[model samples]
Target chain A: MSEFGSNSENGGRVLSFEREEKCHSAGCLELVVQGKATHYHGPRNVDSLLRAMGENSLYANVRINGDVLDRRDFENVSIKTDDTIDILYFMGGGACST
Target chain B: MFDLTDEEILRYSRHIILSEVGGTGQQKLKEARVLVVGAGGLGSPVLLYLAAAGVGRIGVIEDDVVDVTNLQRQVIHATADVDKPKVHSASETMKQINPLIEVDVYHERLTRDNIFPLLENYDIVVDGVDNFPTRYLINDACVMKKKFLVEGGILRFMGLIMSINGGETACYRCVFEEPPPPGTVPSCAEAGILGAVAGVVGTLQATEVLKIITGVGEPLFNRLLQFDAEGLRFHEVNARRNPKCPVCGENPTITELIEYAYTCETQAPGSS
Candidate 1:
């Protein structure tokens, strides 16, 4: 398993299951993750998505679809497929107010 | 209600015609007092747009003289202004843009001792500074004074903006926590910014200021807006006020202004 709990052994099972459900929902929601199109299997919460995006810092804010996800929901709120996840780092290069 | 002369009506006809910024908004703009911190890249567009919008009292604090290289992005300074005090050049341009508005010039650098007194008189503070030390200083000061601040920064082809309404919104420290270790990040001079990128960010800062002054639109409070000019992508990220924030938190650790060590190597002669 990778640090973020991606199990190599379960990869095949996850893909097979996802493929089987692909016909039902057209690949189970495509995520525009971090400014890129991504395909994720099953429903993932905001925290997992953030970890997948290599965001280890808690100073980040996650947006689901078009709404901002509260910090309390990062671990519990499920993000469906086709949802857009924007993980923005709020630091660096702020010479003024930004 | 402000008594608008016939000339004033014609001068701001476009703004006066807009339903959002009618005569009432124009009056608010005329009564607003805004302070812009820098006169370089980001400060240039911010000062120009705010002046053109006819902000009544605009205070600019800049200690540097105009250099030939600053002309690329510091549009407020002209070719003839080279070597002239940037504050003078900026004030002259602002007056030329709108003779009705008053421009106050502070030909000195902002420091811990002077920041509070200088900022107390302004309704809103617009930060266009180019260094991290001053950025943090301004943030802490604004937080303590309970003032609204419009913050922006630009480097290369990317820019970021945020607005903080005292302790109510997410202050700069709430996001960055603390400035990066000195020498860890490159300065604008070292990284070399695209001149036009500064214009994009500074113009947006001015827009935020106008929104704050007139209450026309929802400012970027508790949110961060980042733009990548290269790909033409914009992202708005929600930010939360940290209860553990050193300066603006419930159990705040920082009660006074603390000046961070300056690491910029290209200092003017005699500057400490």
Candidate 2:
């Protein structure tokens, strides 16, 4: 996920093409950009978007499509056809406080 | 009991004629309490229409004294009222408009300590306020108390309106997420607003309040309506409640109130 690749996860578009450019002090996430093809862009999409983002993780827990994935779920989640995903930024934990 | 005499009904004949707002609605107007924050550009119309619509107990909150420049857009105040306390002048005008209604004036700045208590007494809260800090504060208070909020804002030629039913509808935080860092946006005093633009937004806010009170018409919940007077166009975008929203999300983060100091030191350097 270093640069643009014809990964089936991104339809035909490029995925994870840049280097992390420090976003904040917290840290960054390695993203894999799933361009036009798969239209799947998430925290795990691009390495640079992730690197730039640092440790500022988007999702404390998430599920690709319908599969529930928590903090440990980011690496194994596979991209499929017509699956829309959002790399929502979650601070502290996934649960709401107020 | 605020009785409506035949003369009063006659005076409000048009409003009373609507099936949605007959005597019962009129009576609700008499009983309902609304607190309008800010007495400036947007506040002027909100106050004017809410008062005219016969909202029973209307409270106008403002600490700003009237200024000569405000007259161009703040219709509630007159040229002679310049330098007069806005709360005093606005309340005076409301009483003149409808002596039957109760007009409580708060000639004090809206601060965090007072926001919660002040909002608690009102049935509906109208955000005719300009700055983001007060707007966010108002939103938080309303959500926490489950009060209906009618919010309207105008910048230059554009404006936005949202009806927050607290937990029932998308709040102001649901859309923008955060305010534009400070000094990113200019105020009316600096950027300049077409007087009518504020009137339009304020009037729309007043209408939303009436509908919420009278339970009539489609309220602008879950939607952000924008009006661009210069382009003569109106646009509406659907706003969904962010499941992760800090204030109104499914998993809320902001359990208590947090105050963000909002003021602009730059004098229209970035006006408009």
Candidate 3:
């Protein structure tokens, strides 16, 4: 499995569609990513959203509308406009030991 | 019922005036026992505030001593305390703030053998340690003992705070599983943190402890609050308890506390 895939055996999978739909249209979906709202253009998935946020690793968990996104769905799961995505960066140093 | 004397009543009048923390809540604060794990930058504000707020018993565990350099952020210590043990200096300040409260000083580092005994009597554990190994040890110990822990971390201009109610809430392990590889993350010594940032994070930690003691506001349970002092932005992210968390999860793997190898630079003779 790729590094971006779930490490557990119970990992879920996202099936791909034959024809992709564009996320940018007259009625394009808007997403609140990391507290900032942005217009989402073409079939936005977790991977695309993460990329747009300059995040490359799947080590962090992505929450959509208060639910954790399954790692397997990163590439296939479609994100709708108005959805709130919160990316938790758990590794940043916060402990104050000097 | 915990009775407050005339002096006590006047001392904590501000807290008692709050509807959430009336006379009853003030009494609760007087009965709460909180153990703070560090006496440096973060521990300074935590100990001072807990003392000022009338936490009945506050135990501070710190093995280092005050240094002239520490005065930049370890506000609880003064130039006169430069050579004194951190816990001693901190406890002295705490008492000066509120002689009505009791301050216990432990001039020792937190290790696997002493952690449980040190924390067994306290109602809550506040993490102000600046290293990964000790941080992980505290998290695991808190989970094992089912003690509430208010954890905070600060680096450069960023800080994060979370509250863990034993194994019930999302634990430190539930989110990060393990500490990052040594050398991958910069220590405060290497990265340099703004002195005020420590106050921000440590003060938040003290607030969480007070909230836990009096049951006043919503604690940071099951949530991680991150703040960027430079950008002046705050964000809260949802964190769920992981059943696979080695320390708090069912069918657990970490049955006992295991001390991770310490790789940080050795502290100067009296530097925290």
Which number leads on lDDT?
A: 3
Tens-place lDDT digits, model 3, residues B97-204: 899998888898889899988887898999988877788889999988999999988766778899999878999887777765455566677668799989998999
After superposition, candidate 3 runs with Cα above 4 Å error: A1-31, A39-85, A90-98, B265-272
Per-model root-mean-square deviation over C-alphas: 7.7, 10.7, 7.9
In the order shown, the candidates' DockQ scores are 0.10, 0.03, 0.12
lDDT by residue (tens digit), candidate 2, B5-88:
887788778988999898888888878999998888888888888888888899988877888888888899999999999889
lDDT of 1 by residue, B1-272 (tens): 66777888999999999999999999999999998988888888999999999899999987889999888888888999999999899899989989999999999888899999998789898888777677888999999999999988776566789999987899988766777545544556555677788888889999999989888989999988887666566766667787878899899998999877666545321110
For candidate 3, lDDT tens digit of each residue in A59-91?
Answer: 356678876655556888778867887766533
What does candidate 1's lDDT look like per residue over A1-98, in tens digits?
11222222333211111121121343355566544554554436777655654444353556666455565568898877677666654333322211
**TM-score for each candidate, following the candidate numbering:** 0.78, 0.72, 0.81
- TM-score of chain A, every prediction, order shown: 0.57, 0.33, 0.57
Instruction: Give Cα-based local distance difference scores for all models.
Output: 0.74, 0.66, 0.76
The ten-residue window of minimal lDDT in model 1 chain B covers B263-272
- Expressed as tens digits, the lDDT of each residue in A1-98 for candidate 2 is 23222232322111222232222322232222211222222344322223332322332123234333344335555544344333322210011111
